[model samples]
Structure formats: structure tokens, C-alpha cells
Target: MKSNLFISALFALTISLASCNSSNAKPQKKVETEKPDSAATTKIQVALLLDTSNSMDGLIDQAKSRLWNIVNTLTTLKYDGKTPDIEISLYEYGNDGLSEKSNYIRQVTALSQDLDLISEKLFALRTNGGSEYCGAVIQDATKELKWSSENNSMKLIYIAENEGFNQGKINYKEAISDALKNDIYVNTIFCGNKTEGINIFWKDGADRGKGKYFNIDSDRAVQYIATPYDDEIAKCDEKINKTYINYGSKGLEKKRNQAVQDQNAKRVSASNYTDRAVSKSKAVYKNESWDLVDKVKNDANAIAKIQKEELPAELKDKSTAEIQAIVTEKKKERETIQKEISVLAKKRQQYIDTEAKKTKTQDDLGNTINSSIMAFAKVKGYTVEK
Candidate 1:
């Protein structure tokens, strides 16, 4: 009886131990993920070096007409919820009108945020039959331009030419090497067939700079599909222009140039005008260097530094409070116009998308640029909204 009683107690203790062990077991844990550092993001800098020999007239025309579309496409991109500041520099090479001693290369515009000034410089470009110095221009641009030292900034040099890439005194290989040393990717766009461009060493030029090469039909005219919203956007842009109160020495001249560019866009096509209007509506369209309204908004002490005589005729006699009130009124008006353009731009884009699907054509310089830029941007972890 004692042995049987001891066996029963042993069995009870074994069951209790098993229950305690089961209850003491730990639960499985979930894997934790780390967030990305947003500070790693940077801005984009683009230099367009175009061969402006007499044969490149069509190429120049396409560039002028499509500038707005390119600007608009860039505005769609964001890095870590912050929009990247864009600066574009323009260069014209192989134009006899330019000095041969300088390899027939002219820096039309320095890297600038002033989109209107860029447009003006582009429109002013006139082609002449000149020696196409591919190597020399690339070298000069690489060495002359102030490229960003930031590792994250996208510094690109797009050289568009129809001639062989090995032209001029400077060696193409060495020039491209210099570009690489500066972290500037030199992209080559040949105005011919892919095989032809490859045979001319255009592809090799791009490869040396660690960039892509493309061959495009430079003579192809840009086709525009007019949208119903184009008229309204153009009208809204005029209203938006009215809100800008010109101040400072350059303010009046730059403001006048704005209207001149509007006309130039219209000369190209209605679609171009509409696209320019859309670009103007974006935050990238800034005139802070000269415009009082833009300057004052960004700098609190701007008004105090400005000479009273530099103020616009309407604001010259006004008190600081009165000037501020005028600026406030203009800002409100500008915002309303921008919002309207934004809405219309969306509808215009949707219409464009549906129409683009039906066509079998390559885009002009604008879309070509947008394609290359977005591709490079993706590699840098940028988020393109469009």
C-alpha cells in the first residue's frame, strides 16, 4: 500500500512539472525594421551642352519648344518628402558665331534657378556652321562649371551632337575622365541612328563617363495635342503674372522678360504655352534674386536692406506696413491662381496620357531629358510623384 501511494504522488508531481514548464515558456518576437535617413537626399544639377552648328537648327527649335515640359516633369519628383532644388546650365558648341579660340563653345547661361532667364538664353541661340569640338566642349564644361561636391547631388552633363565624339584638340577619353573625377555623368545624345552613333564613338563617350547614350531623330517636329484646359491655364498664368510686384534694380527687367517668354512659348505652340503656365505655377518658378515679394518672403530683413527708390512706383511712397499689406494681397492672389493652374494641369496631364498611348513616337528633347533624369533619380532612391 505504501509503494502504490508513493507511485500515485510521483505521477501527480510529473504532471505538475510539465504544466509549470509549459506555462514558463517565452512567446515568439516580431522582427523590427529600421527607417531610412531622410538627410541623405540631395538636389539635381543639369548642364545641357548642345552642338549648335547650322545643321542643329531643328534640335535648337525642339529644345526651345520643349523646355517647359522638361521643367514640369522635374517638378513631379520628390526626395524624402522634400522637393529637390533644380539648377540648369546651357551651353552652345560648334557655332561659328562663337569664338573659335574657345573651341566654338559658349556658356549661354550659368547654372541658375531663374527659369525665365534660361528660356531667354535658349531662344537667343542662333546656329552657324562651325567646327564641332565634342572633346573640347566636354572638357571645358567639366572644368568650368561649379558642380556640387555633395555625393548625393545628381550632376549630369548631356552633350547632344551629330558629329563624331572624338573631334577637337582635347582627347574624348581624357575629357570624360575629368568629368568622372568631378562625379558628373556625361550623357551623349547623337542626332542619328543608334548604330551610326555607336560607330561615331558617341556610345563610347557615354560609357567612359558612366552614363547612357541615345540616338534620336533630331529633325522630328514636336507634335502637340491641344487640351480644352489649355486656354484656362494660359489665362490663369496672366492673372498670376499680375500679382508679381517688381522691385529692385533687376526686378523690372526680369519681370518684363517673364512676359516676353510667355509670348515666345505661344510662338512655339499652344501646348508649349500651356506647359510654361503649368511650370510657372509650381514652387520651382522663383524670382527671388530680383523680385521683392519673393525675396521678402524668404528673408525677414530684405525690406530693411532695400533702398526706398528701388521699390515699385506703387510701393515707393508707402509705409512698411502698407508695403507688407500689398505683398500679402499679391500673395493671396498668386496662391489662388496657382491652385487653379494645379487643378487644370492634372486634367491636362490625364488627357495627355490617354493621347500618348495611341501614338508611336519618341518625345522631343523634353521627354528625352525627363526619361534620362527619372532613370538616374530612381537609382538615387528618389520618389517621382508622376
Candidate 2:
């Protein structure tokens, strides 16, 4: 009987040990990680606030003609093996056409990737006599636009005006303070002589914001040294237009606007058209919402979401397989054209640089903005390929 009791106690101790070991063991868990957005990793937000009073017609013209130059400069920037999305917002201040109650300022466009629409607005700007309100416009732009919060994003405001920086009810100091609070670098381009600009407090405005100050000859005409590659680049741009399969209600209209912008750029000069084409070939010229090829490439389920009736007239009755085939073909063609354009643009730029060395060209708004962009871009870990 004592031996039987000893065996029973030993059995109880073994069971307790086993139970404690089991309780201490951890259960297997399912770990999950979030996927990165393949589209864009970084962004460059630029706000171009221009004075458009009657005396500043030259400034307006420079803004309109040299927009593509500014865009092309941004196109060369890259960080972490991905090109940044470029969002540009335009503001025209001191135009009498604008309401006095609104301080003669208008937010022409929000920060967006719609390059064509931006070109359209720039072309449409008309000068009028009005009071120049530097503070009001900057404050409005700072408060209104949806600026990126990413520390990597290069956020900047280039306010070009030829008037006293302190010529408004809203103090320039307060505007600069607000801009700095939002992590926006406010660069001032005084559209006159350097001494005159400093006397008018333009340099002070830039100093307060810790941004660059330029006294540019805004009235100077943009010089384009036409290269042998310009014609080929222009042809490639036209070929790209054919690849766009317009879808949705806005597709046709948007596609038409693209053509219109091309024409407008051409009207400026052949080199201007080439610049626009080069910009279009880059990743920043996205029209996914309207272009069927871009839409399908980005989202596999995009076609499934779209109603049959919403498709372009040419693609309305096509079967799903047939539609996919069409998109694939267009995508291939566009890629080829873009590659050709890229090659030609490099050659064109080389030619332009060689000529710039031989000429005594006055500094216009384009080169001025390009200088600032390149300087800032380097600081933000962006490398310009050319």
C-alpha cells in the first residue's frame, strides 16, 4: 500500500509539470506587412505666384512661354530609383480684372499634375491695371493649397512681382511667417533691377523666408536654339497622342485639351513644343483618370469598375479581351515614342547648352527658376541626370 501511494504522488507531479510547460508555450501568430504604393514615393510641389498688372505683361508672358522649361528641369530629378510627382499651382495677383474685395488675387489652379490644364490657364492670363498686394496672395496660397506633409517633398513658392513687397493690408512678415510654419520655402523673383528690387524690400521678403532672391529680367524673350532633334521630338509627341485611348465622360474633352495645349506650345516655337513633348514623355504626365491605357496599367480592376457606356465610342462594343489587347498595343506604342523623345531631348539639350556658352543671353524667368530648382533639388537628395 505505501509503494502504491508513492506511485500515485509521482504521477500527480508529472501531470503538473506537463501542464505548466504547455501553459508557458507561445502560440504561432500570423504576421502581416503593408505593401508600398508602386506609383509615387516622393513629390515636388511648386506654387508660382505671379503679378499680372498691366505693367507686368512681360512677367505673364515669361510665365506662359517658359512653363515647359520649368517642367523639363523637374523631370530630370530622381531620388531612390523613382521620379517625384510634380504638382504646380498658379496664382495671379494685382490684376484689376480680379475683385478688389478679394484683393486682386486669384487661385488659378491648385497643386495638381494636370500639366495641360496649367498651360491653358497660363495662356489665358490677361494683364490689367490694379493694386499690387504681395502679402494677400502669398497668404491665400499658403492657406489654400494642399501642401504635402512628407519631409522629403521639395515644397516651394516662387512669388514674382515688380512692386514693393509690403504693399498690402496683410503684412509681408505675417505671410512669410505662415509660409515657414507650413515648411514652404518662399523664393522671391523681383521683376526689375537688383538694386531696385532690394530698395523695394523684395530681398527682405526672401531673407525672412530663408529662400533665394532673384532680380530677373522678366521682359526678356525666351531664346530657343533650334536643334536638329526638335523635328523628330515633335513627331514623336504627335505619335504619342494617337496612343491615348480616351475613356469616361471627361476623356474625350481632356484628350482634346492635350492637343490644344500642343498647338499652343507649337505656336510659341518648335523648341517650346519639344520641351512640352519631353515633359509629356516623363512619368509626371499622367492622365490615368481619362486615358484608358494609363488607367488599366495602374489598376488591374479599373475596367471592371467602368460601365460599358462610359467607354469611348470606338471601344464601347469591344469585348473585354479585345479591349485589353487594344490597351496593350497603345501602351507599347507610347513606350516606344517616349523612348525616342527621351533620346532626342537629350541631344536637343546638349545643343542648347553649347549655344548658350557662345551667346550673351539675358537671364529670363526660365533660367532663373531653373537655377533655383537645381540648387534646391540637390539639397533634397535629387540628382539631375543632365
Candidate 3:
């Protein structure tokens, strides 16, 4: 009976050991699988908070004109020799059209990769008479948006306003401090005189946030320098547009909106239009939500997964293999067009740069934001490609 008891106890201990090993093994496997691939996971998040009160129409116009220019500038930055995904969020504060209960602020768009949607929202924004609340908007953006927690990711918030920095119930200092905790730097752009901006605590806000402070002439119009390559780039833009195959429920609508945005950019200036075209040639201007070519590029099985009803009329009757063939062809066509545009774009930029040397650099929304982006990116170990 003692020998029987000893064998039973030994069996129980063996089972316990097996159970513990099984449990430990799972967690170890989970950790291995869950480890993030930091090399491919870097991102750049930028939030633009613009005061859209009655006096800030020029600021709005500047934003509209320079949106593509800013995007093109951002495309030049790379982290660890790889280009990071760019996500932009927009906010409009001090607009009386917005709810006063929400401190006259509206989160226009959450941090998103949809460049077209951002352009559409920006174009829709209109100024109205309202009280400006810098601190409230900053605090709201910090808490509400889904900021990346990665230490290597570059996150920035640029708030442009002519009003006093210390406004509304929320304290700017505390708001900026909270932002800093999330690794977000809050830059301030004062749309008036430099001394006036400093006197009104704009500089202090930048200091507290550890970001750059700039005073821009928001009322001044953005000057465009036309180049000989603009016409060729425009032609390439038209050719690239043809390569997009619309799919999904919103595909057709989004395609129409893309054309509308093109018109909007053209209305700004020939140079602005060219800037938008150049941006479209870059990898950052992906429209996977609506474009089948882009969708298939991102997901190898996307063509097989797509429903026949969701495809465009021309593609709806095609078999899966046929559709795939078409997407492949379009992809190849797009790449070729994009390459042509890129070549022309280099020449266009060179001409513009040469012309720009004749004049003093204007401290406008685009220049200030672009310069600050370079400065901040360098500090974060990002390299700029020429």
C-alpha cells in the first residue's frame, strides 16, 4: 500500500508539471508572435488645429492652397531608411457655426490616411464669428485622437491662431503637458505681428510644448511659380487618373470626389495643382478604400475577395481572373505614368527653386510648417531625401 501511494503521488506531480509547461509555452509563443515589427511600423502623425473665426479667412485660404505642398514635403522624410506612413488630422476651432457647448471646436477629421477626404473637409471649412479657444481645442485633440504609442513615430500638433493663447476654461500649459506625455509636440503659429504673438503668449505656449513658434502673414496670398514641366505633369496626372478602377460601395462616389479635388487644386493655382499631381505620384497618396488597383497592391487576395456587384460596370461582367488581369495592367500603367510625372516634377521643382532665389522667402503657412517639419524630423532621426 505504501508503494501504491508513492506511484499515485508521482503521477499527480507529472500531470502538474505537464500543465505548467503547457501554460508557460503558450505565453512564450504569444509573446513571440505579438512582438511588433518596428522596422515597418514607423509613422508620422500631424494634427492641424486652425482657428476659423471671422478674421481668419486668409489662414483658411493658405491651408487650402498649401495642403498638397505640405503633403509633398512630408513624403520626403524617411525613418531608418524607409518612408513612414503619413496620417493627418484636422481641427477647426473658434467657429461660431460649431456648437458652443463643445467650446466652438470641431474635430474635422480624426488622424486618417485618406488624403482626399482631408482635402474635401478642408475645402468645406468656412469662417464664422466666434470666440477663439486655443487651450480647449488642444486638450480635446490630445484626448480624442488615436495617437500612436510608438516611441519612434513622429507626432505633431500645429495650432494656428491670432487670438490670445490663454483662452477658455482649459489651461494651455496643462494641455501641452498632457500632449507631451503622449510624445506629441504642439507647435504654435501666430497669424500676426511677431511681437504681438510673443506678447500674447504664443511664444510661451511653444516654449512649454518644446516646439517651434512662428508668426505668419496669414492675409498674404500664396505665390505660385509656373514651370515648363507643369503641362507635362498635368498630362501625366490625367493619364494616372484613368488607371484607377473603382470598386466597393463608395468607390464611384470617391472617384467623383477625386476629380472634384483636382478641380479644387487647379482653382488654387497652376503650381498648387502641380503640387497635388506630384503628391498623387508618391506612395503616400494611396486610395485603397476606393481604387481596386491600390487595393490589390496592398492585399494579394483582395481581387478574389471582392464581390461582382461592387465592381465598376465595365468590370462587373469580367471573371475573377479577367478582373485581376485588368488590375495588373492598370497597376503597370499607373507606375509608368507616375514615373514620368516624377521625372517632370524634378525639373519643375528645379525651375521653381531657381525662380524663388530671386525673391525673399515668405514666412507663410507652407514655408513655416515645412521648415518646422524638417527641423523636428531631423531631431527624431528622420532623413530627408532630395
Give a tens-digit lDDT track for model 1, residues 275-300: 99999999889998877668877997
Over 14-70, each residue of candidate 2 has an lDDT whose tens digit, in order, gives 999999999988966878686555326478999999898988888887887789989
For model 3, how does the per-residue alpha-carbon lDDT over 192-301 read when each residue is reduced to its tens digit?
99999999999999999989999999999998888999989999999999999999999999999999999999999988999999999999999999999999888999
Q: lDDT score, residue 73, model 1?
A: 86
lDDT of each: 0.87, 0.89, 0.93
TM-score for candidate 3, residues paired by index: 0.93
Of 1 and 2, the candidate ahead on TM-score is: 2
Kindly give the number of clashing pairs for every candidate: 0, 0, 0
Q: Which ranking of candidates, highest TM-score first?
A: 3, 2, 1
Which structure is stronger by lDDT: 1 or 3?
A: 3
Off by over 4 Å in 1: 1-41
Structure candidate 3, residue pairs in collision = none
Deviation of model 3 at 91, angstroms: 0.6
